[model samples]
Target: MMTLALQRLQNTFGYDSFRPPQDQVIEALLAGRDALVLMPTGGGKSLCYQLPALVRDGVGVVVSPLIALMEDQVRALSLLGIRAAFLNSTLDTESAWQVEGALRKGELDLLYIAPERLLQPRTLELLHHCRIALFAIDEAHCVSQWGHDFRPEYLKLSALHEQFPAVPRIALTATADARTRQEIIHRLGLEQAEVFVRGFDRPNIRYRITQKQNARSQLKRFLETEHPNDAGIVYCLSRRKVEETAQWLSDQGWTALPYHAGLSAEVRQAHQHRFLTEEGVVVVATIAFGMGIDKPNVRFVAHLDLPKSVEAYYQETGRAGRDGEPADAWMVYGLQDVIFLRQMLEGSDAGPEQKRIERQRLEAMLGLCEITTCRRQSLLAYFGESEHPPCGNCDTCLDPVETWDGTEAARKALSAVYRTGQRFGVSYVIDVLLGKTTEKVTANGHDRLSTFGIGTDLDLKAWRSLFRQLVARGLLEVDTEGYGALRLSAACRPLLKGEVCLELRQDKRQSGGRRRQVSTDQRLTLPQRELWEALRGLRRELAEQQDVPPYVIFHDATLLEMVQRQPGSLGQLAQVSGVGKSKLERYGDAFLEVLQAHRGDAADL
Candidate 1:
């Protein structure tokens, strides 16, 4: 059975071997055992259950959260010549009925359905009568109420286990902490399932967090340096911001689109479709845009505002570089973000216990943003893994941020806050410290205080950085009632006196030197570049003819391999990593023809 599974993996999925823990998870499910698979995004989590379903005796039923995700997976599978279908709201009644008929006739290998539809009595009755391979739940973290993507409907998924007691079940998620993991197990009734925890580290992604200073220009600078013509995601905290950023990027000559819940469903769907189907498109969106995004080539994920928690941040940024390529996770945050998030948290309807947990998560996220050590190490530590060395990719490791002793500076800043009655925001306090004789300052007569004009040495940017870091370090708190007034926290008393010294990273707002541009066609010669474009042209033509996404026809990685290897025959083409037996038999000759021309031209040259 295991050997057959491996053969199917190569013949159908077009891979020589399985990724780590995939083999184990597949073996368990093939042996009629359940599994709770915790793998990061782009970790090939789908194949853990997908390969087993093919090897098993019946159709695989996948419970997906998003209609777009289900459609994309089904399209990709169908391109591999698999008999896959999805029953979702996107389909008309007649089309859905046809899919149901296929399922009843055992003509489909896999069927993707939303949880709500699958939980219906009618769908359950139909499934009960069919030969059942297994139930695979994608994004299983949604089952946890504590998780950021919680769906109440997922709470009812326990019925799958109860009703299909004889069938194996596999639950998978990209991000889940210990608490959410336990919650998933309890809610999904997967206690007997073997748990597979893959490492949470996405080393290919470079993490960079900057203090917010003109976030729009900063994003542009980063984009120009890092991903000039590549696809990426820029996350914003609000719908208005999403629209504004998207328009701004568009004006800057990017193919940018806005996505948020505030947009009509039709617009959201259309925008998402474009993002998937087109190249060099950037989607500026809120958190609503990226739960099940399967786009593998996102080069960077930039955050204009802080996410609600570290898990949210991790998951959002994980959307980038799903292809295991070098990518970036960049963010810009300030004290205002802190105040905004705190206000949102306090205004929520969650109970005391839930609020407490959320507060801890927020604090952990803040710590990650402000950490002087390796960002990767701190991020992994939050998910309970610790021993990584300093990654030389993040801002701190790359530039080696310099820290200055800011004990007296902090005391002076705090004193200004106090002397100004602690009812002013950061700008007002900074103004007082810088001895700015504004109308409000003169009216308040705050320049008469001892701390006034005391912070002449530090620049405005430095003061902003100090205040932001203080909030991050929990030495300062935001007064919600006072409209984001900066107040000294109890923790600041140590620094207020001479009892403690504070070290802060010196504010350096410069962009790094231009990075080396990595192009997909870099390895190709001038002649090969022509062949690469020709090959891509053929792919786009075939995809358009078949009405599928170009990637569904062949991923950029696969096309690059074909170009590099210049395989001349079906046998040689089969050796390409992504060229499965079915695809080889169907499209091999056409691709081989292109390769042969390129090979001949190269020889002539």
Candidate 2:
């Protein structure tokens, strides 16, 4: 049975085999067993459910939260000649009726519906009448309040399992922490379900976080230097910011567009279409974007502001390098970001305990932003996993930061905060240190303090770095409600009593020859760098021919491997990790010919 399933995956889906954890989940589902699958974004989570739907005797019902997701999946499956359709808010009356008719006729192998729509009485009655071979819940993390994308509608999905107790069910998500995992099981009433947790490392993505200073200029530098003509997503925290950033990038001559909930439906659809169809388009967006986008050529994901938590950050960053090629997950954060995030959390209507948990989450994200250690290691650790020896890809690992014994410096900084009654922001504190005696400083009577001007030896940037590091290390907290006042955490106790030593990364000059060297080394290499364009072109040709997603034919990883290997024959091509006998049999000859001809011409030169 597994062999036949593999053959179908090859002949119909055009894949040679399943990714790890995919077949396991499928087998469980085939046995009429429930399962909770936790895989990463690019880990082939969809195949676990989609393949089983094809083999099952009746229609497989897929419950998804995002309408865009349902539509994309249905279209992709339909292109592969699978009998698939989605019923969502986007469907007109006639289209909905047609889909209903198809379901009644057992024409759809897989049917996707929004959870809210599925809970309707009429919809439930229709589902009851139609034979259901399996039930799948995508983005299952939405059922957990601890997750970033929680929805009230997902709670009702449990009743579906209750009503159809005999049908096999599987819940899948790309991002979920330990707490969220438990919540999903309880909320879905899957007590006896098998659980599969894939490893949480996105090894291909180079994680980077720069301190937020002259952010627009820094972003421009990244665009010009590292990813000149590649497709990428620039995430902003708000709709207004998305529009501003999009316009700003466009004015600077990049093919950029804005996408947010604020845009009209037609405009949003147009923007999405352009992003998917076009190359080198930088989509500036809020969290509303990229949930179900099937584009696989995005080479980078840049966050202009800090995300609310590590889970949100992981999922957003997961958007990059999905094609399994080398991609970047770059972000810029600062002291003000921490303050802003805390303020947002405080303003939420959540209960005090929820607020407390959220604060911890925010602090964890801040730690990743501020740490001198490898960003990848710290991030993985937060998800209850660890990366040994750290990844050599991130900025910290590639270029080790210089550390200074700042125990005395930290003591003085803490004294300054204490002397000021922990009521001042970083700038005012810096002014007092530099002995500027500005009007606000004098008004606060801070100049009379014994610690005033004590940090004059260090420059303003160094002072800022010190305070930022303090806040990141949990020795201090920002009072967001009090206009971003600096408050000491309990960890500050030891430092105040000289019980612990402080070591801090020296503040590197934000601009100079060193910056130039770093930027140049980080620049994308030719061909390997051009892989995105080359793959997109190949994808366009393949998609046009096969009527399937570019991703379905061969992902970014496979294309990059092809370019790197320039395989001259079917045997050499099969050596690539993702290319198996089925894929080679289907499309290998043509791709290899192209690669050989290109390589041959280059060699002649």
What is the lDDT, from 0 to 100, of the residue 169 in candidate 2? 92
Off by over 4 Å in 1: none
Each candidate's clash count: 0, 1
Clash pairs, candidate 1, are: none
Tens digits of per-residue lDDT, candidate 1, 79-170, equal 78888999988899999999999999999889999999999999999999899999999999888777788889999999998899999999
lDDT by residue (1-605, candidate 2, tens digit) is: 67767876876665667888888888888888999998888888888988888887889998988776666577666656788999989999999999999999898899998898999999999988898989999889889786778889998889977899999999998888888889899999998999999988988888878778888888888878878888899999989989999999999999999999899988987787677656688999998888756677788899999999999999999988766667888888777777778778877799998898888888888877767888888988888787456888888887777889988888888888888999988888788877888888888888898888888888877888888888778787777575888878899999889898988876554442122223211444664455445555776798766545566667666776677677778888877766655566767777876776666666776
lDDT of each: 0.88, 0.81
Global lDDT of model 1: 0.88
Error of 1 at 403 (Å): 0.7
